[model samples]
Target: MSLRTSFAAHRRTRARLREERAFERLLARAPTVESAHELRALATRR
Candidate 1:
């Protein structure tokens, strides 16, 4: 594999990890059952 390809892969992995952490934080403070359901739907779409 090329260096550029590896770097791109690493960047994508980091972004996905960041998004997952943000989503977890959202779940933690979701507020209401309806919102939690909405989160679930969003999660499934991902």
Candidate 2:
């Protein structure tokens, strides 16, 4: 509820969004078959 905690949470959210966007871009740049394989591997690993 404090201003400092709220600001920190906002920053964390922004960082997560940026990371997700970058990961999407990474996957977008990969070749189709390779991307599919990589995504599957990541899914199982998760």
Best prediction by TM-score: 1
Clashes of each: 0, 0
RMSD (Å) of each candidate, 1 decimal: 1.4, 2.3
> In model 1, what lDDT does residue 20 have?
88
lDDT of each: 0.93, 0.82
TM-scores of the candidates are 0.80, 0.74
For residues 1-46, what per-residue lDDT tens digits would candidate 1 score against the true structure? 8999999999999999999899889988999979988998989996
Estimate candidate 1's alpha-carbon lDDT, on a 0 to 1 scale: 0.93
